[model samples]
Target: MQRIVLERAGGTPVTKRAHLGAVASGNLEVLCEPPAGDGATIVVSTSVDGYEPVWRATLERFLEQHFIAAAIEINDFGATPAMVSLRLEQALELAR
Candidate 1:
């Protein structure tokens, strides 16, 4: 397993919590909640190792567009970048 952490600044705070998707083969899950501090903190645990760059890129792009301040957890099981982005968006939508 690989763990990745990302911190981003300047975003609208998320008021509600949300959970979306599932951590199964070729899939992943997202858990989002109000931030513990200002900005956003994202923690990812993936079954596939050595994919930190990919995970970072995918998350940075999403955050750049959405700009939401929340604590996000992503549990991944061999999920693709597209799926990751989709799940993040869904979770953010539900959270907002």
Candidate 2:
């Protein structure tokens, strides 16, 4: 698993970005960082899916100040975004 940590930068857009995730038996084309000329977007695509609002809420809840310069998207494999975030945190902590 790959992870990134974004530092606090002023003038960040705290608003939610247009993001989506899907789970399927087929392979997925994922972009970790933002598109070219668009800067970076934090994406976390998993093999999980189902609960949308929970993940959205998870993103909203965990979206504190230090996470400003980043945008994340997770493709869950039967995993909620909250679970995604929890896994992410654990992964990140382990990585650290």
Query: What tens-digit string does per-residue lDDT give for candidate 1 at 1-96?
Result: 989999998799999999988989989989999998899999999999988888889999998898789999999999999999989888988999
- TM-score result, candidate 2: 0.39
Q: For each of the candidates, give the backbone clash count.
A: 0, 13
Instruction: Give the C-alpha miss distance for residue 80 in model 2, angstroms.
Output: 4.0
The window of 10 residues in a row where model 2 has the poorest summed lDDT is 27-36
Per residue, candidate 2 scores C-alpha lDDT tens digits across 1-96 of 233233223323333333323354432322233233332344544444444455445555555523433344445455544445664454333322
lDDT of each: 0.92, 0.41
In candidate 2, how many Å is residue 70 off? 2.1
Name the runs in model 1 displaced over 4 angstroms: none
TM-score of each: 0.96, 0.39
For candidate 2, the clash count comes to: 13
